[model samples]
Target: MPLGQPLRLGRHSVFPPLLMAPMLDITNRAFRTLVRGYGGCGLFYTEMLNARRLPTESAQSPFWQGLGVERDVMVQLLGDDPEALARSVERLLPLDPFGFDWNLGCARKKITHWGWGAALLENPQATARGLRALRQATDKPLTVKIRLPEHGHPDLFKSFIKLLENEGVDAITVHARTAADGFKRPARWDAIAQVKSWTKVPVIGNGDVQSAADAQAMFQKTGCDAVMIGRGAVGKPYLFKTIINQASGATEPAPEAAKVLEAMLTCLDTALETPKGAREFKVFCRYFAQTLPVPHWFWAPLQSMTLGPELAKRARVFFKK
Candidate 1:
């Protein structure tokens, strides 16, 4: 159960097999850097990009910013058109990501309204064709994030996943809920088990993993090759380090509030290095706020402050108290 094992995805191998799920607007460079620094995430993904927008420099440009060549990162793209997706992949090759992942399972209404995301799951044939086109476009690793189908026989879900394996997808990450279920319903970890039984590629289980024990139970119950952390890591990048230590049978000291405060400031400094970074710092503060155990007395004043230096000073005083 050591987290050092390598996970083979087609021709590539990722150590630890723990990926930071591609959360839109939350998994940017500063956040990713903070997670990696804590030590456990094997891969990080960019915010979802649009295939149609990839051709233009302005649209494609955001995906390329703040990423380092040394980091293991993938660009997750949302689109329904196979040709357009292929062209986008072609355009992205020069940027040299660790891989490319197709966003098939995002249940966002705005995304599906444009004929993308989890709506693609409703049409398995088109999803297969899109995966094939993207596979042909690049030799880099390709993965599809999927949600378990709602109101279906288990056999039907198996059939859909088989089609993805048949089409040469490198791996599949199952989010354990249908589009209809939204975030309200409990994630179907049983469905993840069913998908693992059906697929030959690496299966990654995602959803409702909030603790190291949950991470272990996911792997034990589903027999998945990996586990992907989403909202669970927000305000707690140390969650990764804790999980890794637990998996390895090592005892890790509880991260002190002071240490957590330092990590947050480091993330703020990293975010502020970009254009309009102070604005992004405010966004980051929203997530960091979740980690505070006390009442709003600290965050209320910090939120009102506009300057980065002022915010950092307030944060130091808050943590000291």
Candidate 2:
């Protein structure tokens, strides 16, 4: 029944109760700052960073590129080593992050091969120990993003969530899919509802929330404290504004094409500061193109573009009409 209320994560207050989920290379500082311009989402997360490497990583590392001293930003770490995770959190304290998130839901082979992400779920005992260590190490609000197990074990999964709460974790974000299911299966909204029913801690529901209706449905169906949007916000930074507005009983206004292009240009300009900005521009256009009129046609030609100037030129022409 929480409607547009600030979501509390232990001592932290996530206003608006909407979040931009962390996506590797997608939620960079430039992109996040651009999205925030729309002014709806309450929290933003950084790309997954390796806890084991934080101690030795230089500021020039891609992990640190967009991560300045921002308290509203949550840096997510992936690793199963309690000591390393603790040490990494300690080293990261200087950044003054809003909180720390453990990536327990990443299903990629790159992360799983390191015994991180969803692999930790394979050994619930060790995962608990690591989380306990993380809680003992810092007073900052701690959260975890997790995926359910491949096979159904409703009781067991529920117990694991309770265990996380017992270990001093403040909040949980359920992606509503199994580790093995990846993105192929539809997110099980019922699973999120079950977790919400069981835990006193705040729960953030993520997965397949593409539009304002999808977000509203998640809130109504699960009664979750917050809704985290990922791929849905790709080209549409205004999606946040749309959802927040509709949640507050305002009618959703479709974003003007010019507004979408402007946001893309801003992202492009900011990303252009990076070394591989051209490549980044290409990848970003791949998504932003979807928001344009005749997206399929726009997206096809955009794939061949690499430089920002060329892309911007094409974008200006596309929106000029």
Candidate 3:
């Protein structure tokens, strides 16, 4: 079957319902722009910004710079402080993002120690209070991304999500693993379908989606409102187009190596616009390398170059037939 209808995020509607997942350092402006060129992704997310730190972040910091502001971008927030997050949302309101998503799926000890991310699974009351604070602060579409609770009955999980809906959350993206499970276990699509059955709010299923077929299967298997692409989109943004086409019952071959090289070059040039952009270029290329038919042919030289310009030049020469 073709992909479902447009997904409504409060007043906003995103067609095709394929989203580029909120990756910490990878989903910056340059990368989102590169993905946009290939088409299919309906929404882009900023790197998860620290809600408490956002007020103090410099206007020129990498966190604030080189972002795809033109697209339907969702600015994701990470933190446990309800008041601080409300303050941060107030500050961010002027940017006019399509929405905001709370990060409740990150399992890193550094974040969990602060009672944030996956740790919030242990304190549903905090999650409720934070969402209430955010709801009071803005009329923008507010959502949360979560891992399944590390310890909870299915009924408890359902009640927690019901609390989110009551607090005015526009949607929820479930990562399908419990906090303790991290990514070691396969994503439980069965559980995602169960979550879908529990709530009226649009559910976006994330995790283990690596290709067009996988995207199609996630939607079919889970009956989710959408599917999110994370690690899979790093090098293959065109993967979105593939999924979209396949979902529509049309088929398109993956892009040629030359086209992929051109998009990667564009990403490099865009990253070079900022101060530490060379490092950004390297990070993007590191993932972009994996998309190649024989990645090792280009990985060594890409890895050796430290300067963005040099990397771009070598990439051109290497990809040249």
List ranges where model 3 is wrong by over 4 Å: 66-69, 268-270, 273-275, 291-306, 313-321
lDDT ranking, best first: 3, 2, 1
* Candidate 2 error regions (>4 Å): 1-4, 267-270, 291-306, 314-321
Among all windows of 10 consecutive residues in model 1, the one with the lowest summed lDDT is 59-68
lDDT of 2 at 87: 89
lDDT of 1 by residue, 7-122 (tens): 77778898788888988767777678788888888888887888887866563364566554545998898999999899988887877888889998888899989869988887
Arrange candidates, best TM-score first: 3, 2, 1
When summed lDDT is taken over every stretch of 10 residues in candidate 2, the lowest stretch is 286-295
Poorly placed runs, candidate 1 (over 4 Å) = 1-5, 268-270, 273-280, 291-321
lDDT per model vs. reference: 0.80, 0.82, 0.82
lDDT, model 1, position 62: 42
**Estimated TM-score for each candidate:** 0.88, 0.89, 0.90
Candidate 3: RMSD to truth: 2.5
lDDT of 2 by residue, 90-152 (tens): 888887888899999899998889888988767789889899888988898899999877654
